[model samples]
Target: MRLLLLPLLFSLFCGSLTAAESVRLTNGEWPPYLGEQLPHKGVASRIVAEAFALQGVEVTWEFHPWARSLQLAERGKRDGSAVWLHSSEREEKFFISDPVVESGYYLFHRKGYSFDWQQIGDLQGRRLVGTRGYDYGAAFQQAEASGQLRVNRVTSDETAFRQLIAGRVDLFPMDKVVGFDMLHQHFSAAERAQLSFHPKPLRSDSLHLLLSREVPGNAELIARFNQGLAQLRESGKVTQYLLEIQQPLSLAP
Candidate 1:
């Protein structure tokens, strides 16, 4: 009994000495990945929280529009934000973490549109809708900029999907899991049946955590987060957590 108590007491003593380190991060509604309503605030949130815990830090989250989340974090109004595709502009502003999640952006389109594409150029001459301010990828941006592809930018994901189903647009690219989750939540069985995503991904992108450089100690914090993340990966919790969040959409009805 004394031997067991000795180990427990030591653990408690060390834990008390290093308690209460916490961070506030801005997040958005990108469900099954990160959302305000999903279990454990969704899987990515759970991984992030657990990673921080491994480093003896705690996390508190604030939900906002994706753009608003970036704005607040960039201004240092929050410590940082989560789950973004990295760009050089972002790298200049924040201390970015190692890959937090594996994400794929597939082009969603209506059935019977006869769509298939092996390259970005294959999308030329097709009408596409994209959510304003979302980054699809460099190839996508270059195609859009050079006029090889024309896209109608909408303000929200629902609008984009609605446009596709209504035949107002030929295609919309979205995260595979997110697109299906949205379909399951917002569309009728028939409406969902009309939409399908091409199996080929626009870009296989890894989402990341961004720690604002404007916030003091965030540089070190990011390092700690990365270390903790590595530990989590080695433990296979990341893979297990992902599978539990589950699967995607196909246009077969």
Candidate 2:
């Protein structure tokens, strides 16, 4: 009986080693994506938590300012940060997991203001409202660099949208789903109805979970996360999770 018990205990210990205890990830108040007050802390949060659970791991989240969250994760104070866009600079600093959310940039303008642009060049002379710490893609960045466009950098999406409605900016660029969520939640029906999203998207991007390279076993952790994410996708939990967010539009990739 003792010998049999010893083998069982050893197997359990090995299993524990394979299944890490938990991961602490930092995030910010990205509503409908990640927010403390949101149901299950929002869709991306739900997906990440479920994915890790599939691998017998638990996730703990801490909310901070977006910049600080990234700072903490980059310094290895946290295991990782979630729902960040892919950039070459960031790719060097952290190991990004499989795509967790699909996102794209759209030009949001007042309903009374109709404009058409075939390329970034066509945005010349436009007064734009943009959020701080956002990458609006290379084309927009280059155009901004060359003085082709004017942008008023604000602290939050809410501020940007307000500026747009007040005629402070000709166009505001942001993630379509996120921006619309903000508009729907914060503005009146009339105010929301006054907004229009350009038919042509400015850019398409996906958000991913970023693991700190400085952390030990980071590679293995990402591998486990990817496997779990794939499993979630296969089981259709991923789709259901998105649906639970109550997004106004389908998020199909």
Candidate 3:
């Protein structure tokens, strides 16, 4: 009887351990993707969460600075992160899930500015501002390296927007969806009246979930997430959820 009881206890302990070792997600503030206001309400966040949930896996979310969160994911200190733009550089360090969102980079400026640049060379003498640690794709990187584009890095998107408004910077590059969201949330009606977003997209990329190399069974987790997302899309639940959380201002034409 004693030996039988020990085996039962050990089996229970292993089951608990397996449950605890399931999916755990790390993320940071990235509006319309993952952020504080809506908590885990962002499109990418919900998709990833629901995907894992469908697999009978429980997920826990922890927020940190974006860079720090990525570091956590990279080191396997956390299981994964949502809403990361897929990149080769990142691919080298992490396994990326199927695209959960698509966003385009755009040029934002004060309403009165009349800047037009079809190519990097067109901005040879102009100063551009962008969020710290953000990649504007290869063109901008080459321009920066050749000293053709003067770049200013700010700590946050808000700061870049503010500097543009204050005429402290010539141009700022940001994700069109996120930029519009921020503009609606942070700018007063009067302030918004003085700003404009260009129709031209600098670059478009799909956002994905990034898993650390050390997270055991990440391939299985990613496959499950993809399956879940496909189901959500087929059922129209993804669109419905996005509509439910979508801000009125974000729907503006």
Candidate 4:
């Protein structure tokens, strides 16, 4: 009886240790999906936190500018960063997780600007505004790098939208819902009416968490996150969370 009890006691101790395990991650404001003030810091953050919780790991978040968030994660000051598009350069520096969220990107422009595109080539000579530290998609990236299209980079999404409204750029591509949220938050009702997005999606992209390679044991950490994410998906909670944020919008004037 004493020998059997000893193994049970050790198992309980190890289980408690795993239950207490926690990690801090960096994140940025991209409301309805991710924001400091939003509940559970928005859906993406909530999903990440809950998924880790499923694996008995607690998560804390540090909010910063998107670029700064990436830097902190890259330097291993934090465990990882939530929600970023994939790029070849990032793949080398971090262990990318499974798709954390579905991100539909669309082209936003002023109401007066006539924008149309059938392919990447359609953007030729158009003054496109791109936000830095974001990967629009593979085709757009390839076109921009080869000078087949003209893309002027901005430091933030707000700046890109502002430039578009001022007619400084021919078009601005952004996450469809994120773009709408930004416009509603920063611009007046009239201003919101003056902006519109093309119905065609630029990319139906998947956002992923990036855990830095500089941190020891992060490979295992990423694996755990992916496994937890798979559980979330299998349980149908992921779709339920997404449905809550997709309130019907009257975007057109």
Candidate 5:
């Protein structure tokens, strides 16, 4: 009886240990998506947290610079990154979750600038503002590579917009919602009035949570996260979370 009881107690302890397992993810200060000050750490962070909660796992986030965030995840310093764009290079080292949100890229120019483009070819000879370390898309990247488009690279989106307002660049491309968030935060009403997003969006892509393959148990973690995300979508929680930020679920499409 003592032997049997000892085995049962050990099993219970192991089960509790499993139940208390948690994951730590690195995140960058991307507002309206993921931020330290925003409610529940912003929409995307809330979604990721709740989804993992549903899987009986807890998650904690540490803020870092975007490049460092990816590096930490990739090197197994953290279990994963809270969110990032899926790329072939990233895919090589990480297990990417189902997309948490879709992002659209649009060209923003100063109002009255009369700039418009229907295709990449139309961008020839144009001065495009690009953020350092950001990937716009294959077409835009290829165009920049071939010298079809000249880009003035800046360190951040805010800097890019400042350059645009200063007439330093012809146009800039950014996520519509993210660009608006920046406008709300940094630009005066007068400055806001001077800017507009082009009617033609450059492209759209989905953002995903990337679990580093180098991290132990990451495969199971990714599977659990994906399952929870699907459940959140079905239950309309994802939509509810977006509405809290006054952003429409439709924006993600």
Candidate 6:
């Protein structure tokens, strides 16, 4: 009876430990999508948190620079990173979760510039700015190589937008939805009035949650996350959550 009781107590302790397990999550300050502010609660953060909660997994969030966050995750310093673009390089370094959101890159310019780019060559002689460390797809890369476009690469979307507004650059690349949200949330009415998004978007990409390769059972964790995400999508909760936090701007006259 004493031996049996000891085994039962150990099993109970293991169960308690599993029940209270938690993981540390990290993300960058990307406004409208992920940021250190209100209302913007970071769309990817919210979705991933909700999904993990359903699995009884608790997470603590740390905010760091985008590059630093990825670095930490890759080095096994953090459990996972949020809102990452899936890429071959990243895949080799981290375990990626199911895509959480779809976003496209668009060209933004001063309101008066004509939006007529039939080909990459059309952008030649025009100054363009884009976020550094982002892949705007192969076409833009080809244009840059051919000297068809003058490119200025900045570290953040806000920096790119500010550069365009300050006349430091002629055009900037941004995600259409995120660009609109930033304009609505951060830009003053006057500043927003001076900016406009081109009708043609440059590239479309999916965003995913990335886990550190060092995390125990990383593949299993990503599989669980994907399963949860699928359920959220099927229930339409994912789209609804996106819309709820997305504040659209009304163009001022």
Assess each prediction's global lDDT (C-alpha) against the native: 0.90, 0.87, 0.79, 0.88, 0.87, 0.81
Order of candidates by TM-score, top first?
5, 2, 1, 6, 3, 4
The superposed Cα distance between candidate 6 and the true structure at residue 112, in angstroms, equals: 2.9
C-alpha RMSD of each candidate structure in angstroms: 4.7, 4.2, 3.8, 4.2, 4.2, 3.4
Model 1 TM-score on a 0 to 1 scale: 0.85
Better model by lDDT, 4 or 5? 4
Which tens-of-lDDT digit does each residue in 1-253 have in candidate 2? 9988999999999998877789999988877889988888889998999999998889999999889999999989999999898888998889999999888789988877869999998888888888887889989988887888888889888999989888878999988778867777878777777788788999998889999998998889999999999999999988887776655643221
Off by over 4 Å in 2: 1-20, 246-253
Clash count, one per candidate: 0, 0, 0, 0, 0, 0
* lDDT for residue 62 in candidate 6, whole number 0-100: 88
Shift in Å, residue 244, candidate 4: 2.1
Per-residue CA lDDT of candidate 4, range 31-93, in tens? 989999999999999999999999888999999988899999999989899998887899998
What TM-score should be assigned to candidate 6?
Answer: 0.84
lDDT (Cα, 0-100) at 212 in candidate 4? 94
Every model's TM-score: 0.85, 0.86, 0.84, 0.80, 0.87, 0.84
lDDT of 1 by residue, 82-150 (tens): 988888999999999999998888998887889889988899999999999888888999999898889
Pairs of residues clashing in candidate 3 = none
Higher-ranked by lDDT: 2 or 3: 2
Give the Cα-based TM-score of candidate 5 against the true structure: 0.87
